[model samples]
Target: QRQAMANNSRPTPTMAPNNSLRWERCSMDIDHLSLHCRQHSHTVLTEATPVPQWIDDRVSLTQVLEAMQASPMHVLDTEFERVRTFWPKLALVQVALPARNVLIDPLAFADLGDLGRVLGNGRPWLMHSASEDLVALKPLTEHAPTALFDTQIAAALLGLGSSLAYQKLVQSELGVSLAKSETRSDWLQRPLSAEQIDYAADDVIHLQALCDRLGDRLDRLGRMDWLWQDGQRQIAAGYELLPSANPHHEFRAAYKLPLAAQVRLVAVLEWRERTARSTDRPRSWVLDNATAIDIAQNPPRSGPELLGKLANCRAFPRRQVGEVIDLLASAEAGAPFQPAPAPLDRETENALRQAREQIDALAAALALESSTLCSRRLLEARARLGTWPPDCTRWRQQLLEPLVQATLGASSPTQNP
Candidate 1:
């Protein structure tokens, strides 16, 4: 009986009219939400949604390409895995156009270049948080957002929240709560659960509504350009070395300057990045910041030299030390490509902090998780870029950056907030 209750204790009317699943009577209160999560934690995992027969192998790449080619650019999201692996396994793909919705089964047909075109050269898309989705798509295609608008960016612009999840954004924006049951499901599973499929599709279902609300808010405030800037920033951040780009490419070239310091900063960061790749671990795990900086400051040309002063050397194999030295030498010999520099200004910095507060407060007012919508780092990057947040990063621009810009005189006031 207890087991049955546990299994059956899910949201009633298990599926929504839109075929998406939702949680029942979820509390909006922060404490209550946390308590409820800790209690019935099984469901609150990941976007484990259902996969309809239409999305099977029969769902040809031709059909997808035809749709993508015909439709105005669309908003997309994806889920993947990166646990002790060289490549992040593609899990699910959520595509949201103005009038239609799609949930692609990556296990069925992973590649989408013939279908999905990214890179800021196409129609605008309304992605939520683009970083994860972008990284996941790297193994599949060179999908850089052509034209982008992150809903999370928009939410920030509206001062709704810093960073919010699609579910939380939907609830706050449309008063519709989503289920958390599949928040951590094994997305690679073949026969996905009915509940899981619903959860996955739900990630992009309300994106159109999200875009409508955020677009209007951005326009009303005359901060549409903020959307473009956010998109560009996301693209700059979204660039991931192809699985083959350099197995050891630091997850990105982020530790270049202000983030890292010195002339050999890029070389040191790249060395650590390649080391992480060869080991198939995160850059942070391979070499912590302080040690990386120290080693970078004084490069070791020989394996013995590298293993000499480094503290984490013991953590790695001695044989790997030689390879590490080689990589370090190579990096030192060549320069890493730097993305357009992120500018710094006192006003934008202050704006970033104030917008973070404003967005957090607004999220509380709407009963949403601020982190799900936007983040301080993303906001800071946006401000530094001195551009409007785009819409393609899963409403991130709407929910956070616009409001931040409004405070910074980077954007005008909107009617919504």
Candidate 2:
């Protein structure tokens, strides 16, 4: 049974300057299981004091899991590397429970399915800017947490500023300055440096207190529900593993291409996405965007021409040149291209402008960024489709639906065409 921490009124500990805290030995017991701190030395465990522990072995992981299972909420963060891969390489998993901060080594364990199961249990997870972290964690967790309280989302709802960096949020909420010196360190390297460990530990050390402050502010503003709804949306978007269905839409220059070339561009983009995912490589590594566009506009007739086009591109499969040539040939012989929806006409543009003004006024009244309440893209999409974006949250729809209807009308029959 998950139990909420009854007392959240703990003092926020002063962060060690420059993230240079030295470790001493300390020990504690949970349900009579002796647990020792791997990094920090604290004589007495308090709710405010973060006891950093390294979970490198199954035994340690079991202890950490037990502690985590008992907590109602956890402050979670991840350090990952994805410089050249489509998928994030999860380097470290940092989790903060009331008095314990854990640095779980994903490299040490081959499988973390058990850990993932506990994490996905109905209890809430406190995270800051959770989207990327959630993506990095999907390999282990397989799904988002049942409940998530993203500190960044909470901060935004309280008008603390949208997209606040973890360091800046910590500084703003707890008056603590954290160092970012080891941000670029190679987390896959064994025997992590003391500085790196310190940096990693500091990532989650203050999250509990930060979540408390932000959650309280959101509660007082009557926007906590908004934060939760946005958190769920963020989680869903983050964990969406498949490539976008309309990958061609991302290429702004594709619109200038002829209908046939545009169709080729769509096929090439889809192929690139699938290739990147299958090979665990980046889309650029498979085929760069500029090259993809060029090939679509002026496809090679033979293998040598294709080879010349891809000569400068590294990591692309030389053997796949024939395949790409064949693919382009098939696209040329495929059915006629269907043109995309036309750009907004002057009348629709005016309606979109009016909708923006009303949304801006509502955002100002709620002490939110206008874009945060409803982005211009979403507003424009509404004008084009004559319906609200399906992804708009309940709170946002409740506030903006009537205003949008008034400004843009209930529906526009000719808007989409």
Candidate 3:
């Protein structure tokens, strides 16, 4: 199926006369069309929107790479489908260069390692909400970019807003209204619709302009390093392949389980994680959280009983019931289970409150969002452990350490009445 698509091609657009700009239609196939432009001078296309070029062939991809090499930075975005899979399936990649915009079809090429290398070659990538895109690109690019500028994070740091949607940010920052009708369209289908192509093109088209305006604000605020720090953190998290070590902790009710049941829960969760990755299915499909918790709370005596418990779980393998029974038995007989940490005690709760107040004051002084500085979960962990959260960035820690220390000190048993 893919070979037929790869074999398809159309003639390249002719260049315009010197010192003149011209828009030419370039077709990748009968159903897929792209627009290319030829210009004498290199300038960022902010005022006039350009149609995205369709690059499905090696020659076209190479030409795009050459154009990218001459530029210091590029704006990037991706469209993917992850509804039924453990990993994101890359459908399309949109890139905005100084001269042109192009959409590369991942389904047409057997290998994209070359494109990945070029993208991760240390040149800055300007993206909005880059976490998922980074993960989607991992199969093609093994290494993350050395430098990244996430416009969403940059805006949040500047007190603009937190978790702002791409369209909203573009509208607010650049006064550009982008259509969102094709957001839920299926990208994996062959011969993507013209609306889908246009929507994909718009995703990265104005990213450079938005980045320029937000970046200047960040530079003036002296928070560009902070944005970079957070960007790197996002990259690290996105590329993480392993499931969380403490998967059970993700459930709010896991803390209520007895020590042995909690141990069983952890084992089951880890098994589910491994199974999901190996089978390329979602974790919930292998074993729903509620079902896992139920099984852990009430250990089935035999495979029949386990099967009965999983009657409602359509995706769980019926043949694995015996295996799961054995796993539960082993967990029950394993070494003494470490009791999960109890909920925050009164003193610690007070400390968390104090720490939050301090953070609010600090944020106000810095003119930054409090959540951007520290999340409540991180604060609770800090107050409970009397140490900085491991994920806390250096810049944030430097600004927040004194407040954390003061809060903990004030709540110490010796100091408290």
Best by lDDT: 3
Query: How displaced is residue 215 in candidate 3, in Å?
Result: 0.8
Q: What Cα-based lDDT does every candidate model obtain?
A: 0.56, 0.72, 0.74
What is the lDDT for 144 in model 2?
68
* Runs off by more than 4 Å, candidate 2: 1-48, 332-343, 411-417
The per-candidate count of clashes, in order, stands at 81, 0, 0
Residue 34 in candidate 2, Cα distance off native in Å: 37
Give the best candidate by TM-score: 3
Runs of candidate 1 exceeding 4 Å displacement: 1-54, 58-61, 97-100, 110-112, 117-121, 240-268, 277-280, 290-318, 323-417
The per-residue C-alpha lDDT of model 2 at residue 320 equals 81
Candidates, ranked, lDDT: 3, 2, 1
True lDDT of residue 275, candidate 1: 66
For model 3, residues 1-417, the per-residue Cα lDDT tens digits are 233333432221211223223222222221111112233342233334445688899999999998887666657999999888888999999998766778899999999988988887766677889988888988887777766689899889999888999989877765667789998889999888766776787788767656656666676677767776787678778887657667776787778998889889988888888878878788888888889999999989897888787765666777778888889878852454444566888987887888899899999998878998899877776676566655676687777777878767532222100
Q: Which is better, 1 or 2, measured by lDDT?
A: 2
Query: On a 0 to 100 scale, what is the lDDT of residue 110 in model 1?
Result: 42
